[model samples]
Target: MNNIKKSQLFWASCLALLVTSLSFGIRAGILGKLGTDFQLTATELGTITATAFWGFPLAVVIGGFIVDAIGMKRLLVMAFIFHLLGIVLTIFAQGYWTLFISTLLIGIANGTVEAACNPLVATIYPDNKTTKLNHFHLWFPGGIFLGTLIVILFNSIGLSWQIQVAIMIVPTLVYGYLFSKLDFPVTERVASGVSTATMYKSVTSPLFIFMFICMFGTAITELFTGQWIDVLLKNVTDNAILILTLTTGVMVIGRGLAEPIVHRFSPQGVLLISAILAALGLYLLSTLTGNAIYFAAFIFGLGVCYFWPTMLGFVAENIPKSGALGLNLMGGAGMFAVSVYTIFMGGFYDRLILKKLPAGANEADYLSAAPGTEMANLLNEAKNAAGPEVLQATLVIPIILVVAFTGLVIYMKNKKKEALTH
Candidate 1:
């Protein structure tokens, strides 16, 4: 432990995570522009977006299995190479296939960062897993806030989306340099002398399997809505990007103050409450209009702020024997679910708009219609009508979460009682 530089290593991990999140924030901000420029349908755009989600799980799950053997430094090196390649490819992207490949590269880089960092943080701060993990993860929202603000700033000045993406390279290079020079400690599983077989066995436990399933709902509720916010809320809000910015800003603050909150409610209690607030927030977003939507964004941000980190922290603290595999598996599952749902939601949104069009109107009728023509007007109206309905349709996820988290809370309580009795 004395050979390792803890503060320097931790901050470097934060910076690496910042780069990963910047990719998410920037890609989300540019989604509409890509669609318009490439003449893509909502479903096609969704497929491109889903590539990142799916690619993420692939890297994280694979990286999880080999991280202990290959070491954190090697994994981060892979992230650095992929980040550069992905950014350059995206800048030169011509159409659907190019965008899909580039976003997948970036997603792989993003997942690799998490695969290394989550276990790294857990290893260094064994005394305060949940609170410290929350602090470490604040950067996810913090970086998103910065990314959205960059988009707003660049767009306001008539800058190209390509330029917005290029800004990520600076941070990528910085984190790459930092990790290159630093010495890394062993993973928590190795440090604690837990056997590989024991770690494998632990992940198959009932509680772990339960949480793995629950992660799908939690992630889709947060990431799916966030990534699609611009399109989903464009008709409902004046500046849909601002809604994303505001929510991420609120999340940064909430995660920063997580220690006391976790102390008061415990992780299970917080998850239950977060599920309730998230459901209410989404419902409000579906029904609210104008300035009132900001309030809903705030609530939504608060609800999801602690979800990702807290979930990881719970597994690390309770199932220590499961090690890096458990942590990465949970994250990988969440991302995989989001990938599948992204396409579903996009198709669903497209279908809703199609259903709302007049009987004789086909998609071509709207796309080929000249601006200011009656067909164009009808298409606009249909989009406006379908947007809120799309949000309403997503409410089922968080609503189900409310029930699921309640059960988790009760289950944890019983487990605690049984432990005490023994």
Candidate 2:
């Protein structure tokens, strides 16, 4: 009825994120089913999964550049269309190419949501980027938690996977309606008339570059690990859905509670602590078992809950001149890292499975390795041992982040003191 309210746009954005995250939850939940039905290997599945991550950066970067020209509303509309189409195609996906192309479209839609919403939030709440961005991102895990439960519920009732996916159509249409009549805002960069050259310059700045590079590790730590929760925990537990829900549940709650922490500590301070917990959590997941694994997952969720949004928030606050391009590139860089790691991990899992199982093991044989028996014990042992190895390798990224973010914390601390003195 009136011009768009920031609150209206924010919830619309949350719904968009919920759709994106629900896709991920559904994809993760169906990994085993997809692999079995399609007769695919881990390497093949990884290749398919990589499409989602690959398409995101491409769209986000391009969307970043054109968002100001086309308007955020139009960009979001495109995202909605893509989201709808991607889901339809995914439901009908018959094989590798079909799934890949469908997922790639969905990935683009997901990136579009971030490209539009990240800057949208920053523009609307300029004074509180970190805290608000954290709040804005809370929906990501919240969606995942909800989606996982939906899948679990559906599975318990012998529902089809297609139905699980089709359920997302509800949120998709709701967001489309919410955004349809609302007016949109001009981007922060455009309102300020930040020159194109200035945007590029900010992107190339050393600080921006440092943050960009660090995003790769942070993205992989959260997304790559998260996207594979079902497969990774398949041998560890019967309720992978519950485990997925639990990890994301912790993230939802952790992020929900982040305002006070963000208030007390600087974003860098928060990031520093997050990196420590992430590394420790990954190691624990790799090394520990049974109940301890759940604890480790909670820690890991807390570690990553702030990384993506806070990184964007930091760039928004610290690199105001960079504008939408900076935010888009940060998101793009993270997804790109996720794409690379997904492929690498998938291939690694394929190789690991080969080493563990007999040379000619088939899908039935693989699935037959039950949880409590000898073959299952061997399978679980192999997964636990090999699984942690990949996680341990990933630990190197956060360990390095610990050092880099510490330097950032000190630098920001000094910068703040200098401002106070001035």
Candidate 3:
């Protein structure tokens, strides 16, 4: 790439990173704060999260088509509309339904930002797709680090969560303004002479089907952590700011080191190791307390650091024609899976554990601030309502099932190719 194009790409990556940082950095804190304010049940909290991912399922379809039709310039601008409206509605949202609606808008905006930018990044750094993709994505976690700081600032100053959400507008407008100046690549679906039918044919083949499995696993594993760390810390410490600082700080440490680790393991090998550690960490996280819980979260973060970028890189390498359309579609599918899992998680949390966890004890607060066994009544309630088994199931969904299959696919493909060469 020329000097001018490289510079533009760097700025564009920054724009994408900033927007993503805003979304992830403050999202979990936002959910915890909402639960505190509204007395939301765990199930309700899941619904709130679902709204964000719900946009993922549909937005990719919309973004995939429109990003090409209208161009990323307009689509990128439209992406911010979701965030702006979402923040406004969130500020005014008093009830569960209203909250869901606003969150859905926010989810769509998150989806659009990615849908537009992933393709733009691919076009910008076409040669080094994996490295550029990893570097480009360094911003998502970087944004999370920033968002945590912002959360600390607002909480220390006694600001409302709505105001914290309103901060998203900064990146939104900044990226929207920056995107206005650049040109983005067209979607491969449009550029390739393939119709929807032909595209569908290729995508549904064994390769695409396996890729979908990887995407779903990657999505849920990363999101479940990002969306819940606040809740995990909330259960123990009333100091929300302190908790955000510690958990996010540690996670930042893990992600910051991902680039070097990824080079050593390769994305797939890294994912394999991370998946095993994550499932164990999640189970340990739910069951343990004090140092144990905190330690487990760190382990979980270490495993998750590579999942997102590795999954994206895997698809990009495998599906040459997908461009932004394919990446966004996979991402959308992954998030949609998250939405479904969140509902089940909430239901399990509400129906089984909350009902039994002692009288006059707020379940939302209890889950948000996952207490240790010292809270004997709540502990017994948690034990009776559910057990380590249920928690283990949720954490291992990706590793136990999805990773197992993905491993098989990798093995078989390699063996088949080796035989042909021989």
Give all candidates' CA lDDT scores.
Answer: 0.90, 0.85, 0.68
Using TM-score as the measure, name the better of candidate 2 and candidate 3.
2
Candidate 2 lDDT tens digits, 160-225: 888998998899989988888778889889888899899999999999999999999899999888
> Where does candidate 3 stray beyond 4 Å?
187-198, 236-263, 358-390, 401-422
lDDT of 2 at 231: 76
- Report backbone clashes per prediction: 0, 0, 5
* Worst-scoring 10-residue span by lDDT in model 1: 360-369
lDDT of 2 at 208: 96
Q: Order of candidates by lDDT, top first?
A: 1, 2, 3
User: Which candidate, 1 or 2, would have the higher TM-score against the true structure?
Assistant: 1
lDDT of 3 by residue, 1-422 (tens): 47686678567656656765666667676776787567677688888888888886778667875676687767677777777788788778988888989888878887887777777776666655666666666677667767878887888899977788788777777776677776655554566565665554656667667767777776787776567556544444454334334444554566556667767766566667867776777766667755566676667666666677667776676665655666777878888898898888777766666556677766545644543544544654463435343456667675564456457558756966999999
The alpha-carbon RMSD values of the candidates against the true structure, listed in the order shown, are: 1.3, 2.7, 4.4
Off by over 4 Å in 2: 1-4, 359-385
Please name the candidate that would achieve the greatest TM-score relative to the true structure.
1
Off by over 4 Å in 1: 2-4, 368-370
Name the top lDDT candidate. 1
